[model samples]
Target: MKISIPFLGVLFLVTACSQPQKSSEAGDAESAQSKFAHSPLVEHIYTADPSAHVFEGKIYIYPSHDIETEVEEDDMGSHFDMKDYHVFSMEQPGGEVTDHGVALKLEDVPWASRQLWAPDAAEKDGKYYLYFPAKDKEDIFKIGVAISDRPEGPFTAEPEPIAGTFSMDPAVYQEGEDYFLLFGGIWGGQLQWYEDQKLVEGRKGPTDGIPADEEKALMPYIAKLDGSMTELAEQPKEILILDDEGNPITAGDNAKRFFEAAWMHKYGDKYYLSYSTGDTHFIAYAIGDSPYGPFTYQGNVLEPVEGWTNHHSIAEFEGKWYLFYHDTELSGVTPLRNIKMAELTHLPDGKIQTIQPVN
Candidate 1:
């Protein structure tokens, strides 16, 4: 109809009429998901430096909580009452979860006189064992253990620090018939066995002493464990060194930043050892065929994405591999860290692909 229209009527038509934008919007969403498909899962968290393990069809995350008092003082003190050890359960598929408060606390353990941090938990023979680091009155970080019948625990502590070498960050793993505990800080490394000696009853040995350099050389060790939490062999020996292609990781710039929170994982015939590069805030990994040997640096597996640090763990859950790690919330090196989990897929080649953040 070629009828003349009033100015107001024309204005109304112009405001209401436009090209359909549905197709463009749909295209944008598809592009986003396609980009994010290779990325890690994102989440909000109250914990940091998380170590995860699945038990009885459920995943348990043991991390250090930022107590309010610790935040207020702006001091990562060596003593505190609010260690904030908690347990959470996630049901099959996806659903809301619940927090069971304070799985292990400082006062709960008889020998703990200070800060508790960096906890890792696992189950063996139907019993759950939590390995964590705490301080004595002297403020030195040492590793200890707690045991409970269930994953969510009101756990009981052993008589003393489980196996510590004036260090923190305890990681335990079961290799074949042996349970090996690998832990250390920048000072170096130590490995412990869960079998064979009388921990309570003293042992008579030679009073001979070793040189300072000889003592310092005693790190990056591996040993076998029996039913008892005692070393089945002599002191741990340094051996783990190998390349991503199963070659020896030689001493050089490629071998720089090889110390700190080193944890090993075995997948099929390859062994993956992940560790944090000190001060760089990046996570690097090495590969080996054996748990104890030369592991070649695979380079940084993951790094800070959008102002987040790459200090974390890559673990498998329900047949799917996931990277579970932490990041700072406040800008410029904030201590208030948050946990993140993302799915990890292995490439045809040996090296692991770096993970990206998901929306």
Candidate 2:
């Protein structure tokens, strides 16, 4: 992966911003005093939509690198004009975090145009793969993969995005020898515009013309990845989230339906599928006996935070579980957000205790 000198200069600025502040710095002292469990993982630069994984012996976080922009805010998320990604790592939860400079950027992506969103990382055959969502040159969101020799990456993107992929928030879940891409988002994320595996022309979301109460809720998609992990092994399929009556969650049931940010993890013999209830501002989860699931809605894992958007990833490290999420506590602006993590607890009955974000 070749990086230009100009990009290296930008990395220098990013690194400077990521440096730990001296105690004499008043702002740093003040922030340190008030820091709590839900505080931003890194105060230097904004980050959100954290997709955390325990690679090797350390916890590495792959999150959207949020930047301040003049783009007007809207329900379509135009204000979130992020254009790159950065990887952060730590020895353990609540410990010091090291920001690994730019892993992938829009200028380096051949097929991407703008809006580099949430990303996830996976390791196979001694190589690390970073999966991210970005708007293609045609302005449609597509998932892409970048490769790195190490978990903390200055990754080189593939010449093109993975074919047969759309929408955003690509979360890769590995089980045994198989890897599956779990992805989708509504509204600005563009999941609503797709129908029958293709983008529907002149499509409108529920707020525009579609009746939420009568229509089945849009679902997140999952498809197996071939050994190379760059392309889908088969056509993507919807992972159903069902209500107690075994009915598919309806679009109107915003409190219990899938919104965006799909993450999968296995606990015991059950597969847990968790996601953000976009407008509802909750991190909810469902459980199934298999990876490809008709999961039964369990309950929320996180409550509303300071911001409008909610995204999260769950992983167990060193016999303890943690839920990595983001809120706008630092900037207090919807688009400029930060990532956070809290210890998560699962009960004996397989239910997750709803976590209320610290004020």
Candidate 3:
């Protein structure tokens, strides 16, 4: 099912009709649904691992800019060989998307060697911050920060990667005046190589010698961001995900355990932590009382998509919530992915209704 195509230079915009139509009856259930047709927000180029946010009343997306490359695919994500990032924005969900060319590039990062992976963005004190994961000169994944005055940016990178960051998919969540960074990914993302805050050379996972059924699942991490918003204020801590009975979800439970792409959002009084079930290809979530959580596994937010990886972001726009994610629909290849969006609903009982990607 994996097929690659030559890069296309032409830029095409696919307008989405994602707005919910008004109904005659007050609070009609049918009217509450979005009419969004699941399709690539942009088709001229490939983009993935969408980190969407609503800034200044507009929907801004920070996604990994995917390009066709000669690198062979591997479990360590050797094939994703992305070199840059582009910022996209829309007036609203399912609207015309604007691609603000080349927000940041690999060549521009002084400390990074290769692979500009999934990124997230935040705004503070009239400045925009772009948080991204890239392999440094040592070939280990480290999170870095870029700054800009505009949401869509020609961002400038810091002189070095954040001191203690050691993994991929950097997602930033802010509540009131506090900002937290949630991150980590295993396998090709190389999160497994680090233990006890340092690299454990030649470490292996379940496929090596560890028994999946008995080994506790690897968990994503969260650290408070200092007021400057560029570095972690404290040491990273594991965000444990447990089952209904309070036991940690085991590594064998691929369908529910965290793999990568950590995201956090708040609804009413509860914090929702969602992530990709890497190999299983599901986007699942858990609910916790706080941002730093011992969350209880809830359920899947999205079913399997058209590729081996599923990365997503959730944001509220104009009183409705949407799930932004990526799939290989355009290239039919795993690494070359395109971003898409769908309506996400939180039911009356606080559980997310599972979303099925449209064909």
Candidate 4:
């Protein structure tokens, strides 16, 4: 675990220097009639990053449950060890998906106790929040919010979090009455492991190399949320996902910009944003008009999913447009992944259509 460097040299933060591997533990998870029409609509349970929401009209989701890593051999079990969260409703989008089991857990969050990572779900005025990026009892990694009225949830958290945000994925969007809150991308390391894991906010550069401005890569963070989804209706903005003449497209082998799983939606007058290009496993997008963004990257709606973390959540339900990602091919367990969906096609210059995963 030591990496205090003088020449840790040759190590460009392979997620803090890779070496934790193995995926032979899990065996029984592959049912639901044996999957495959596009796979992973929940094959027993091993879900991953999906956020997905449509709430009252159906399509609910909100994943992150993959707990199959005993850790000991090369240890990276905490690599993404989520504790709970399982809201899975559906009325369409391939139909029949309802596993509303435990909509929030990690000891019911009193400030989170584990790495219950990558989450997002929203609905206001009538209430139904759920947004987490866990690890609190001083394990750091903050960003919380849970309060439910049902979307298949018993949610009711908020022991203290969502104050000045920290790191990890936590998407939320709701234009018109305003409530943005997109979280960070310290997903792999840089900005000096996001300032030595204080998780970004000044004076922490070069945790390895290559940051002469990866298109103003400030380590993914965004804000705007005050109607009591938990505070911070302003003062937070570092999003940089452009590149078409708009600029700021870091080009890390180019999967468009801004890594980490950001996910915002709206499609007619435009305001897309979709993230998770972090270390490039796909799921890229950007094309804003509001909801705070200079966005424009416009490409890859969901392409490279095998696993290294590429989160998602985009809805539509009865009218279609789906893309809730996650996959390590049914838990060969690259950090224990699962959840997958495909079906997003739109054209006429608004652009979006690049799906490929369904083995």
Task: Please give the lDDT score for candidate 2.
Answer: 0.84
User: How well is each residue in 117-167 modelled by candidate 4, as lDDT tens digits?
Assistant: 778878887888888888788565678888888767779888888777776
lDDT of 4 at 187: 31
Per-residue lDDT of model 3, residues 153-259, tens digit only: 98999989997888899999999999999999888777777777688767644243223676788889999999899989999999999999999999899899988
- Supply candidate 2's per-residue lDDT for 353: 86
Which regions in candidate 2 have their CA more than 4 angstroms from the true location? 1-37, 204-211
Model 2, 148-249: lDDT tens digits are: 999988899999999999989999999888999999988888888877878888875534432367577888999999989899999999999999889998
- Steric overlap count per candidate: 13, 0, 2, 1
- Measured over all alpha carbons after superposition, the RMSD of each candidate to the real structure, in angstroms, is 13.8, 5.0, 8.1, 21.0
RMSD of 1: 13.8
Reference-based TM-score of each model: 0.70, 0.90, 0.89, 0.31
User: Higher-TM-score candidate among 1 and 3?
Assistant: 3
After the best TM-score superposition of candidate 3, give how far the Cα of residue 133 lies from its true spot, in angstroms. 0.6
Worst 10-residue lDDT window for candidate 2 reads 18-27
Give the residue spans of candidate 3 off by over 4 A. 1-37, 204-211
Query: What lDDT does candidate 1 reach at residue 286?
Result: 75
For 1-359, candidate 1 gives per-residue lDDT tens digits of 11122633564455532211112322453563463323211122245667777778776767776443433431232222246476665543233444556788788876677667677876778788887777666444566788899998967877677542345666766776568776654431111111122121231121112123212212244544446543223354454555445544432332334445667777768988887654465677877777775677777766644333345666777777877776543212334445656767777787788765533
Q: lDDT at 288 for candidate 3?
A: 98
Candidate 4 deviant stretches above 4 angstroms:
1-50, 53-60, 63-84, 94-99, 108-111, 114-132, 142-166, 170-193, 196-240, 249-284, 287-312, 315-320, 323-345, 348-359
